[model samples]
Target: MYFFLSHLSVCDILISTNVTPKTLQVLLTGRHLLSFSSCHTQLYFFGAFTGTECCLLSVMSYDRYLAICDPLHYSFIMKRHLPQFLATLCWLVGFFVSMIIESFVVALDYCGPNVIDHFFCDLTRLLELSCSDTKMTDICVTIIVSIIGIFQVVFVIVTYICIFTSILQISSITGRQKIFSTCSSHLAVVSTYYGTLIALYVAPSSGHFQTLNKVLSLLNTIITPLLNPIIYSLRNKEIRSAFSKNVLRRLKR
Candidate 1:
Protein backbone atom coordinates (compact mmCIF):
# COMPACT_ATOMS: atom_id res chain seq x y z
CA MET A 1 0.00 0.00 0.00
CA TYR A 2 2.79 2.38 0.88
CA PHE A 3 4.41 1.55 -2.44
CA PHE A 4 1.27 2.62 -4.34
CA LEU A 5 0.94 5.64 -2.01
CA SER A 6 4.48 6.88 -2.66
CA HIS A 7 3.76 6.74 -6.38
CA LEU A 8 0.50 8.64 -5.79
CA SER A 9 2.42 11.31 -3.87
CA VAL A 10 4.77 11.67 -6.81
CA CYS A 11 1.82 11.85 -9.22
CA ASP A 12 0.14 14.49 -7.08
CA ILE A 13 3.31 16.55 -6.98
CA LEU A 14 3.78 16.26 -10.73
CA ILE A 15 0.24 17.38 -11.49
CA SER A 16 0.42 20.19 -8.97
CA THR A 17 3.74 21.36 -10.42
CA ASN A 18 2.17 21.36 -13.88
CA VAL A 19 -0.88 23.39 -12.92
CA THR A 20 -0.56 25.25 -9.61
CA PRO A 21 2.19 27.81 -10.30
CA LYS A 22 0.72 28.88 -13.63
CA THR A 23 -2.77 28.90 -12.21
CA LEU A 24 -1.73 31.09 -9.28
CA GLN A 25 0.15 33.37 -11.63
CA VAL A 26 -2.88 33.85 -13.83
CA LEU A 27 -5.16 34.40 -10.87
CA LEU A 28 -2.85 36.84 -9.10
CA THR A 29 -1.39 38.76 -12.06
CA GLY A 30 -4.78 38.96 -13.77
CA ARG A 31 -2.98 38.08 -16.96
CA HIS A 32 -4.71 35.23 -18.73
CA LEU A 33 -2.55 35.47 -21.81
CA LEU A 34 -1.38 32.05 -22.97
CA SER A 35 -0.28 30.85 -26.38
CA PHE A 36 -2.24 28.15 -28.15
CA SER A 37 0.63 25.69 -27.94
CA SER A 38 1.30 26.43 -24.27
CA CYS A 39 -2.37 26.08 -23.42
CA HIS A 40 -2.67 22.69 -25.11
CA THR A 41 0.63 21.56 -23.57
CA GLN A 42 -0.77 22.23 -20.11
CA LEU A 43 -4.01 20.59 -21.13
CA TYR A 44 -2.18 17.45 -22.25
CA PHE A 45 -0.17 17.05 -19.07
CA PHE A 46 -3.14 17.87 -16.91
CA GLY A 47 -5.34 15.40 -18.75
CA ALA A 48 -2.66 12.73 -18.55
CA PHE A 49 -2.11 13.22 -14.83
CA THR A 50 -5.80 13.27 -14.08
CA GLY A 51 -6.27 9.98 -15.90
CA THR A 52 -3.19 8.50 -14.21
CA GLU A 53 -4.44 9.49 -10.78
CA CYS A 54 -7.82 7.96 -11.53
CA CYS A 55 -6.18 4.64 -12.35
CA LEU A 56 -3.81 4.91 -9.39
CA LEU A 57 -6.65 5.54 -6.96
CA SER A 58 -8.47 2.49 -8.26
CA VAL A 59 -5.25 0.54 -7.85
CA MET A 60 -4.97 1.83 -4.30
CA SER A 61 -8.50 0.73 -3.58
CA TYR A 62 -7.62 -2.74 -4.86
CA ASP A 63 -4.59 -2.72 -2.56
CA ARG A 64 -6.70 -1.83 0.43
CA TYR A 65 -9.32 -4.43 -0.43
CA LEU A 66 -6.68 -7.13 -0.57
CA ALA A 67 -4.98 -5.93 2.62
CA ILE A 68 -8.18 -5.83 4.62
CA CYS A 69 -10.33 -8.50 3.00
CA ASP A 70 -7.73 -11.13 2.24
CA PRO A 71 -4.92 -10.60 4.72
CA LEU A 72 -3.79 -14.21 4.54
CA HIS A 73 -3.19 -14.10 0.77
CA TYR A 74 -2.35 -10.41 0.58
CA SER A 75 1.41 -10.79 0.22
CA PHE A 76 1.05 -13.58 -2.28
CA ILE A 77 -1.51 -11.66 -4.33
CA MET A 78 0.14 -8.26 -4.21
CA LYS A 79 3.66 -9.46 -4.89
CA ARG A 80 6.76 -7.31 -5.14
CA HIS A 81 6.74 -6.93 -8.90
CA LEU A 82 2.95 -6.41 -8.91
CA PRO A 83 3.05 -2.90 -7.47
CA GLN A 84 5.61 -1.79 -10.06
CA PHE A 85 3.48 -3.24 -12.84
CA LEU A 86 0.31 -1.58 -11.57
CA ALA A 87 1.97 1.82 -11.20
CA THR A 88 3.45 1.61 -14.68
CA LEU A 89 0.09 0.58 -16.09
CA CYS A 90 -1.48 3.60 -14.45
CA TRP A 91 1.00 5.99 -16.06
CA LEU A 92 0.78 4.34 -19.44
CA VAL A 93 -2.99 4.34 -19.49
CA GLY A 94 -3.18 8.02 -18.60
CA PHE A 95 -0.50 9.29 -20.96
CA PHE A 96 -1.66 7.22 -23.90
CA VAL A 97 -5.22 8.48 -23.60
CA SER A 98 -4.11 12.10 -23.33
CA MET A 99 -1.67 11.80 -26.21
CA ILE A 100 -4.39 10.48 -28.49
CA ILE A 101 -6.92 13.11 -27.48
CA GLU A 102 -4.55 16.08 -27.39
CA SER A 103 -3.17 15.23 -30.84
CA PHE A 104 -6.71 15.70 -32.08
CA VAL A 105 -7.25 18.73 -29.87
CA VAL A 106 -4.17 20.53 -31.20
CA ALA A 107 -5.18 19.82 -34.79
CA LEU A 108 -8.24 22.02 -34.28
CA ASP A 109 -7.47 25.73 -34.80
CA TYR A 110 -8.22 28.49 -32.29
CA CYS A 111 -8.99 31.55 -34.46
CA GLY A 112 -11.42 33.44 -32.28
CA PRO A 113 -12.22 34.53 -28.72
CA ASN A 114 -9.70 32.86 -26.36
CA VAL A 115 -10.91 34.02 -23.02
CA ILE A 116 -11.10 30.77 -21.01
CA ASP A 117 -13.33 30.98 -18.02
CA HIS A 118 -11.47 28.29 -16.16
CA PHE A 119 -8.14 28.81 -14.41
CA PHE A 120 -6.25 26.20 -16.43
CA CYS A 121 -6.41 24.77 -19.91
CA ASP A 122 -8.95 22.06 -19.29
CA LEU A 123 -10.05 19.58 -21.95
CA THR A 124 -13.62 20.84 -22.01
CA ARG A 125 -12.48 24.46 -22.13
CA LEU A 126 -10.07 23.66 -24.94
CA LEU A 127 -12.91 22.15 -26.91
CA GLU A 128 -14.74 25.44 -26.65
CA LEU A 129 -11.78 27.31 -28.23
CA SER A 130 -11.74 25.49 -31.54
CA CYS A 131 -12.86 27.50 -34.60
CA SER A 132 -14.24 24.44 -36.38
CA ASP A 133 -16.85 22.00 -35.19
CA THR A 134 -15.53 20.04 -32.16
CA LYS A 135 -18.15 17.30 -32.23
CA MET A 136 -15.62 14.55 -32.84
CA THR A 137 -13.22 15.67 -30.12
CA ASP A 138 -16.06 16.17 -27.67
CA ILE A 139 -17.42 12.72 -28.46
CA CYS A 140 -13.99 11.20 -27.97
CA VAL A 141 -13.52 12.78 -24.56
CA THR A 142 -17.05 12.01 -23.45
CA ILE A 143 -16.58 8.38 -24.47
CA ILE A 144 -13.23 8.14 -22.67
CA VAL A 145 -14.69 9.59 -19.51
CA SER A 146 -17.78 7.45 -19.74
CA ILE A 147 -15.79 4.26 -20.26
CA ILE A 148 -12.40 4.59 -18.54
CA GLY A 149 -13.23 7.18 -15.90
CA ILE A 150 -16.50 5.61 -14.90
CA PHE A 151 -14.95 2.14 -14.81
CA GLN A 152 -12.26 3.31 -12.38
CA VAL A 153 -14.83 4.92 -10.13
CA VAL A 154 -17.00 1.83 -10.19
CA PHE A 155 -14.04 -0.44 -9.43
CA VAL A 156 -13.17 1.64 -6.38
CA ILE A 157 -16.74 1.44 -5.16
CA VAL A 158 -16.90 -2.35 -5.55
CA THR A 159 -13.58 -2.81 -3.78
CA TYR A 160 -14.67 -0.69 -0.85
CA ILE A 161 -17.93 -2.56 -0.53
CA CYS A 162 -16.02 -5.81 -0.28
CA ILE A 163 -13.58 -4.24 2.16
CA PHE A 164 -16.41 -2.99 4.31
CA THR A 165 -18.02 -6.41 4.35
CA SER A 166 -14.76 -7.97 5.42
CA ILE A 167 -14.33 -5.41 8.17
CA LEU A 168 -17.81 -6.10 9.44
CA GLN A 169 -16.93 -9.77 9.70
CA ILE A 170 -14.21 -8.98 12.25
CA SER A 171 -15.33 -9.96 15.73
CA SER A 172 -13.40 -7.40 17.68
CA ILE A 173 -14.67 -3.83 17.70
CA THR A 174 -11.12 -2.51 18.00
CA GLY A 175 -9.98 -4.50 15.00
CA ARG A 176 -12.89 -3.28 12.94
CA GLN A 177 -12.30 0.30 14.00
CA LYS A 178 -8.59 0.04 13.28
CA ILE A 179 -9.23 -1.34 9.81
CA PHE A 180 -11.86 1.31 9.15
CA SER A 181 -9.51 4.04 10.28
CA THR A 182 -6.85 2.83 7.88
CA CYS A 183 -9.19 3.06 4.90
CA SER A 184 -11.49 5.94 5.85
CA SER A 185 -8.96 8.61 4.95
CA HIS A 186 -8.37 7.08 1.55
CA LEU A 187 -12.10 6.69 1.04
CA ALA A 188 -12.68 10.35 1.80
CA VAL A 189 -9.97 11.43 -0.60
CA VAL A 190 -11.30 9.16 -3.33
CA SER A 191 -14.83 10.44 -2.83
CA THR A 192 -13.80 14.08 -3.20
CA TYR A 193 -11.52 13.47 -6.19
CA TYR A 194 -13.88 11.20 -8.10
CA GLY A 195 -17.03 13.01 -7.11
CA THR A 196 -15.87 16.32 -8.53
CA LEU A 197 -14.63 14.64 -11.67
CA ILE A 198 -17.91 12.84 -12.29
CA ALA A 199 -19.81 16.07 -11.89
CA LEU A 200 -17.50 17.83 -14.32
CA TYR A 201 -17.65 15.22 -17.04
CA VAL A 202 -21.05 13.61 -16.67
CA ALA A 203 -23.15 16.75 -16.40
CA PRO A 204 -24.04 18.77 -19.50
CA SER A 205 -21.86 21.85 -19.74
CA SER A 206 -23.41 25.17 -20.81
CA GLY A 207 -23.21 28.90 -20.10
CA HIS A 208 -25.81 28.46 -17.39
CA PHE A 209 -23.40 26.33 -15.32
CA GLN A 210 -20.17 28.02 -16.30
CA THR A 211 -19.48 29.23 -12.78
CA LEU A 212 -20.18 25.75 -11.40
CA ASN A 213 -17.81 24.19 -13.89
CA LYS A 214 -15.00 26.59 -12.97
CA VAL A 215 -15.47 25.90 -9.28
CA LEU A 216 -15.41 22.17 -9.84
CA SER A 217 -12.36 22.52 -12.06
CA LEU A 218 -10.65 24.54 -9.35
CA LEU A 219 -11.29 21.76 -6.84
CA ASN A 220 -10.15 19.02 -9.25
CA THR A 221 -7.10 20.73 -10.73
CA ILE A 222 -5.69 22.68 -7.82
CA ILE A 223 -7.31 21.92 -4.49
CA THR A 224 -7.67 18.16 -4.80
CA PRO A 225 -4.07 17.56 -5.87
CA LEU A 226 -2.83 19.75 -3.03
CA LEU A 227 -5.10 17.98 -0.55
CA ASN A 228 -3.99 14.45 -1.53
CA PRO A 229 -0.49 14.36 0.00
CA ILE A 230 -1.66 16.13 3.14
CA ILE A 231 -4.67 13.85 3.45
CA TYR A 232 -2.66 10.63 3.08
CA SER A 233 0.52 11.56 4.95
CA LEU A 234 -1.07 13.41 7.86
CA ARG A 235 -3.43 10.56 8.62
CA ASN A 236 -0.73 7.94 8.32
CA LYS A 237 1.38 7.23 11.39
CA GLU A 238 4.36 5.84 9.48
CA ILE A 239 4.50 8.87 7.19
CA ARG A 240 4.10 11.28 10.10
CA SER A 241 6.86 9.50 12.02
CA ALA A 242 9.21 9.61 9.07
CA PHE A 243 8.45 13.28 8.46
CA SER A 244 9.19 14.06 12.09
CA LYS A 245 12.42 12.10 11.93
CA ASN A 246 13.71 13.68 8.73
CA VAL A 247 12.01 16.98 7.89
CA LEU A 248 11.24 18.13 11.44
CA ARG A 249 14.72 17.26 12.58
CA ARG A 250 16.25 19.29 9.77
CA LEU A 251 13.96 22.23 10.54
CA LYS A 252 14.80 22.09 14.25
CA ARG A 253 18.47 22.48 13.46
Candidate 2:
Protein backbone atom coordinates (compact mmCIF):
# COMPACT_ATOMS: atom_id res chain seq x y z
CA MET A 1 0.00 0.00 0.00
CA TYR A 2 2.80 2.38 0.88
CA PHE A 3 4.44 1.65 -2.44
CA PHE A 4 1.26 2.53 -4.30
CA LEU A 5 0.93 5.60 -2.05
CA SER A 6 4.40 6.83 -2.88
CA HIS A 7 3.49 6.65 -6.55
CA LEU A 8 0.28 8.52 -5.81
CA SER A 9 2.37 11.23 -4.15
CA VAL A 10 4.48 11.46 -7.28
CA CYS A 11 1.38 11.82 -9.44
CA ASP A 12 -0.01 14.54 -7.18
CA ILE A 13 3.28 16.42 -7.30
CA LEU A 14 3.49 16.19 -11.07
CA ILE A 15 -0.10 17.37 -11.43
CA SER A 16 0.34 20.35 -9.10
CA THR A 17 3.72 21.24 -10.58
CA ASN A 18 2.19 21.12 -14.06
CA VAL A 19 -0.63 23.50 -13.31
CA THR A 20 0.02 25.55 -10.17
CA PRO A 21 3.06 27.71 -10.89
CA LYS A 22 1.60 29.24 -14.01
CA THR A 23 -1.71 29.67 -12.21
CA LEU A 24 0.05 31.47 -9.36
CA GLN A 25 1.85 33.68 -11.82
CA VAL A 26 -1.45 34.57 -13.39
CA LEU A 27 -2.85 35.36 -9.98
CA LEU A 28 0.16 37.37 -8.77
CA THR A 29 1.16 39.27 -11.90
CA GLY A 30 -2.29 39.33 -13.52
CA ARG A 31 -0.71 37.95 -16.70
CA HIS A 32 0.24 34.56 -18.06
CA LEU A 33 1.95 33.55 -21.28
CA LEU A 34 2.96 30.32 -22.91
CA SER A 35 4.41 29.42 -26.26
CA PHE A 36 2.57 27.04 -28.52
CA SER A 37 4.80 24.12 -27.62
CA SER A 38 4.84 24.85 -23.89
CA CYS A 39 1.07 24.97 -23.58
CA HIS A 40 0.59 21.66 -25.36
CA THR A 41 3.36 20.10 -23.30
CA GLN A 42 1.59 21.11 -20.11
CA LEU A 43 -1.70 19.82 -21.47
CA TYR A 44 -0.17 16.46 -22.30
CA PHE A 45 1.42 15.94 -18.89
CA PHE A 46 -1.71 17.11 -17.13
CA GLY A 47 -3.81 14.55 -18.93
CA ALA A 48 -1.23 11.83 -18.39
CA PHE A 49 -0.92 12.33 -14.64
CA THR A 50 -4.65 12.70 -14.14
CA GLY A 51 -5.33 9.55 -16.12
CA THR A 52 -2.61 7.68 -14.21
CA GLU A 53 -4.07 8.78 -10.90
CA CYS A 54 -7.50 7.52 -11.90
CA CYS A 55 -6.05 4.10 -12.64
CA LEU A 56 -4.00 4.19 -9.45
CA LEU A 57 -7.04 4.97 -7.32
CA SER A 58 -8.90 2.07 -8.88
CA VAL A 59 -5.88 -0.13 -8.24
CA MET A 60 -5.78 1.00 -4.64
CA SER A 61 -9.42 0.18 -4.18
CA TYR A 62 -8.73 -3.31 -5.48
CA ASP A 63 -5.85 -3.52 -3.04
CA ARG A 64 -8.07 -2.64 -0.12
CA TYR A 65 -10.70 -5.06 -1.30
CA LEU A 66 -8.20 -7.90 -1.25
CA ALA A 67 -6.86 -6.94 2.14
CA ILE A 68 -10.28 -6.72 3.67
CA CYS A 69 -12.12 -9.39 1.71
CA ASP A 70 -9.51 -12.11 1.48
CA PRO A 71 -6.83 -11.77 4.07
CA LEU A 72 -5.36 -15.27 3.71
CA HIS A 73 -4.73 -14.91 -0.01
CA TYR A 74 -3.87 -11.23 0.01
CA SER A 75 -0.11 -11.61 0.28
CA PHE A 76 -0.03 -14.34 -2.30
CA ILE A 77 -2.16 -12.40 -4.76
CA MET A 78 -0.41 -9.07 -4.32
CA LYS A 79 3.05 -10.48 -4.80
CA ARG A 80 6.15 -8.33 -5.04
CA HIS A 81 6.13 -8.09 -8.82
CA LEU A 82 2.37 -7.64 -9.07
CA PRO A 83 2.13 -4.14 -7.60
CA GLN A 84 5.01 -2.95 -9.74
CA PHE A 85 3.36 -4.39 -12.81
CA LEU A 86 0.10 -2.67 -12.00
CA ALA A 87 1.80 0.65 -11.38
CA THR A 88 3.71 0.41 -14.63
CA LEU A 89 0.55 -0.46 -16.46
CA CYS A 90 -1.16 2.60 -15.01
CA TRP A 91 1.65 4.87 -16.17
CA LEU A 92 1.76 3.38 -19.65
CA VAL A 93 -1.97 3.55 -20.23
CA GLY A 94 -2.07 7.13 -18.98
CA PHE A 95 0.67 8.33 -21.31
CA PHE A 96 -0.64 6.44 -24.27
CA VAL A 97 -4.18 7.73 -23.93
CA SER A 98 -2.94 11.27 -23.41
CA MET A 99 -0.83 10.96 -26.51
CA ILE A 100 -3.84 9.94 -28.57
CA ILE A 101 -6.00 12.79 -27.21
CA GLU A 102 -3.26 15.34 -27.55
CA SER A 103 -2.78 14.29 -31.13
CA PHE A 104 -6.42 15.07 -31.77
CA VAL A 105 -6.05 18.51 -30.20
CA VAL A 106 -2.83 19.29 -32.07
CA ALA A 107 -4.31 18.28 -35.39
CA LEU A 108 -6.84 21.07 -35.08
CA ASP A 109 -5.93 24.50 -36.45
CA TYR A 110 -6.02 27.36 -33.96
CA CYS A 111 -6.16 30.36 -36.32
CA GLY A 112 -7.08 33.04 -33.84
CA PRO A 113 -9.01 33.85 -30.61
CA ASN A 114 -5.75 33.14 -28.82
CA VAL A 115 -7.09 33.91 -25.38
CA ILE A 116 -8.29 30.89 -23.36
CA ASP A 117 -11.05 31.65 -20.92
CA HIS A 118 -9.62 29.61 -18.09
CA PHE A 119 -6.28 29.53 -16.28
CA PHE A 120 -4.34 26.89 -18.18
CA CYS A 121 -4.43 25.11 -21.53
CA ASP A 122 -7.29 22.72 -20.91
CA LEU A 123 -8.40 20.27 -23.60
CA THR A 124 -11.93 21.63 -23.87
CA ARG A 125 -10.78 25.24 -23.95
CA LEU A 126 -8.29 24.39 -26.67
CA LEU A 127 -11.02 22.77 -28.72
CA GLU A 128 -13.25 25.79 -28.16
CA LEU A 129 -10.60 28.15 -29.49
CA SER A 130 -9.73 26.15 -32.60
CA CYS A 131 -10.86 27.59 -35.96
CA SER A 132 -11.08 24.11 -37.45
CA ASP A 133 -14.16 21.97 -36.98
CA THR A 134 -14.02 20.51 -33.46
CA LYS A 135 -17.02 18.20 -33.55
CA MET A 136 -15.02 15.05 -34.16
CA THR A 137 -12.29 16.03 -31.70
CA ASP A 138 -14.88 16.80 -29.07
CA ILE A 139 -16.61 13.51 -29.63
CA CYS A 140 -13.35 11.58 -29.37
CA VAL A 141 -12.24 13.30 -26.20
CA THR A 142 -15.65 12.85 -24.65
CA ILE A 143 -15.64 9.16 -25.44
CA ILE A 144 -12.13 8.63 -24.07
CA VAL A 145 -12.81 10.50 -20.85
CA SER A 146 -16.15 8.76 -20.34
CA ILE A 147 -14.63 5.31 -20.69
CA ILE A 148 -11.76 6.08 -18.33
CA GLY A 149 -13.81 7.84 -15.68
CA ILE A 150 -16.82 5.55 -15.69
CA PHE A 151 -14.78 2.35 -15.73
CA GLN A 152 -12.63 3.42 -12.79
CA VAL A 153 -15.58 4.69 -10.81
CA VAL A 154 -17.53 1.52 -11.39
CA PHE A 155 -14.57 -0.71 -10.51
CA VAL A 156 -14.03 1.14 -7.26
CA ILE A 157 -17.69 0.97 -6.41
CA VAL A 158 -17.87 -2.76 -7.00
CA THR A 159 -14.71 -3.45 -5.00
CA TYR A 160 -15.95 -1.42 -2.07
CA ILE A 161 -19.27 -3.21 -2.13
CA CYS A 162 -17.45 -6.49 -1.80
CA ILE A 163 -15.23 -5.07 0.89
CA PHE A 164 -18.26 -3.89 2.78
CA THR A 165 -19.88 -7.29 2.51
CA SER A 166 -16.81 -8.87 3.98
CA ILE A 167 -16.74 -6.36 6.78
CA LEU A 168 -20.37 -6.96 7.63
CA GLN A 169 -19.65 -10.62 7.91
CA ILE A 170 -17.56 -9.82 10.93
CA SER A 171 -19.88 -10.15 13.92
CA SER A 172 -18.14 -7.53 16.03
CA ILE A 173 -19.03 -3.88 15.55
CA THR A 174 -15.43 -3.01 16.41
CA GLY A 175 -14.22 -5.20 13.59
CA ARG A 176 -16.53 -3.56 11.12
CA GLN A 177 -15.51 -0.05 12.20
CA LYS A 178 -11.83 -0.87 12.13
CA ILE A 179 -12.11 -2.34 8.66
CA PHE A 180 -14.10 0.57 7.31
CA SER A 181 -11.69 3.08 8.81
CA THR A 182 -8.85 1.61 6.80
CA CYS A 183 -10.51 2.61 3.54
CA SER A 184 -12.59 5.62 4.49
CA SER A 185 -9.76 8.00 3.61
CA HIS A 186 -9.36 6.40 0.23
CA LEU A 187 -13.10 6.64 -0.32
CA ALA A 188 -13.02 10.33 0.57
CA VAL A 189 -10.21 11.06 -1.87
CA VAL A 190 -11.83 9.06 -4.62
CA SER A 191 -15.18 10.76 -4.20
CA THR A 192 -13.74 14.26 -4.26
CA TYR A 193 -11.38 13.56 -7.15
CA TYR A 194 -13.83 11.75 -9.40
CA GLY A 195 -16.81 13.93 -8.58
CA THR A 196 -15.01 17.04 -9.73
CA LEU A 197 -13.35 15.27 -12.64
CA ILE A 198 -16.56 13.87 -14.16
CA ALA A 199 -18.37 17.10 -13.57
CA LEU A 200 -15.66 19.05 -15.37
CA TYR A 201 -14.96 16.70 -18.28
CA VAL A 202 -17.87 14.33 -18.80
CA ALA A 203 -20.65 16.87 -18.42
CA PRO A 204 -21.51 19.08 -21.33
CA SER A 205 -19.62 22.35 -21.41
CA SER A 206 -21.34 25.68 -22.05
CA GLY A 207 -21.03 29.45 -21.64
CA HIS A 208 -23.45 29.16 -18.74
CA PHE A 209 -21.08 26.84 -16.91
CA GLN A 210 -17.66 28.20 -17.86
CA THR A 211 -17.11 29.69 -14.40
CA LEU A 212 -18.27 26.49 -12.73
CA ASN A 213 -15.91 24.52 -14.91
CA LYS A 214 -12.99 26.66 -13.82
CA VAL A 215 -13.90 26.13 -10.17
CA LEU A 216 -14.17 22.37 -10.70
CA SER A 217 -10.87 22.38 -12.56
CA LEU A 218 -9.26 24.19 -9.63
CA LEU A 219 -10.48 21.47 -7.27
CA ASN A 220 -9.22 18.66 -9.48
CA THR A 221 -5.85 20.24 -10.40
CA ILE A 222 -4.86 21.97 -7.18
CA ILE A 223 -7.04 21.21 -4.18
CA THR A 224 -7.31 17.43 -4.63
CA PRO A 225 -3.55 16.99 -4.90
CA LEU A 226 -3.05 19.11 -1.79
CA LEU A 227 -5.63 17.07 0.07
CA ASN A 228 -4.37 13.56 -0.80
CA PRO A 229 -1.39 13.60 1.57
CA ILE A 230 -3.27 15.40 4.30
CA ILE A 231 -6.11 12.92 4.06
CA TYR A 232 -3.81 9.91 4.20
CA SER A 233 -1.64 11.32 6.96
CA LEU A 234 -4.61 12.17 9.09
CA ARG A 235 -5.53 8.51 8.98
CA ASN A 236 -2.13 7.49 10.36
CA LYS A 237 -1.86 7.13 14.10
CA GLU A 238 1.88 7.75 14.28
CA ILE A 239 1.68 10.81 12.11
CA ARG A 240 -1.21 12.23 14.09
CA SER A 241 0.62 11.60 17.36
CA ALA A 242 3.76 13.30 16.16
CA PHE A 243 1.73 16.19 14.80
CA SER A 244 0.08 16.67 18.18
CA LYS A 245 3.43 16.56 19.95
CA ASN A 246 4.88 19.15 17.60
CA VAL A 247 1.89 21.42 18.12
CA LEU A 248 2.28 21.15 21.90
CA ARG A 249 6.00 21.89 21.70
CA ARG A 250 5.37 24.94 19.55
CA LEU A 251 2.64 26.09 21.92
CA LYS A 252 5.04 25.92 24.88
CA ARG A 253 7.40 28.30 23.08
Weakest lDDT window of 10 consecutive positions for candidate 1: 198-207
211: Cα error in model 1, Å: 1.8
Candidate-wise lDDT, in order:
0.86, 0.92
Q: What's each prediction's clash count?
A: 0, 0
User: Can you write out model 1's per-residue Cα lDDT over 71-150, one digit (the tens) per residue?
Assistant: 89998988889999999999999999989888888888879888887778877777787798899887886787689976
Candidate 1, residue 50: Cα displacement in angstroms equals 0.4
TM-scores for the candidates: 0.89, 0.94
Model 2 poorest ten-residue lDDT run: 198-207
The residue-by-residue lDDT of candidate 2 on 1-253, one tens digit each, is: 8999999999999999999999999889787888889999999999999999999999999999999998899999999999999999999999999999999999999888888777889887888789999999889997998888889999999999999889878999998899899999999999999888878765656768888888899999999999999999999899999999999999999
Error of 1 at 104 (Å): 2.0
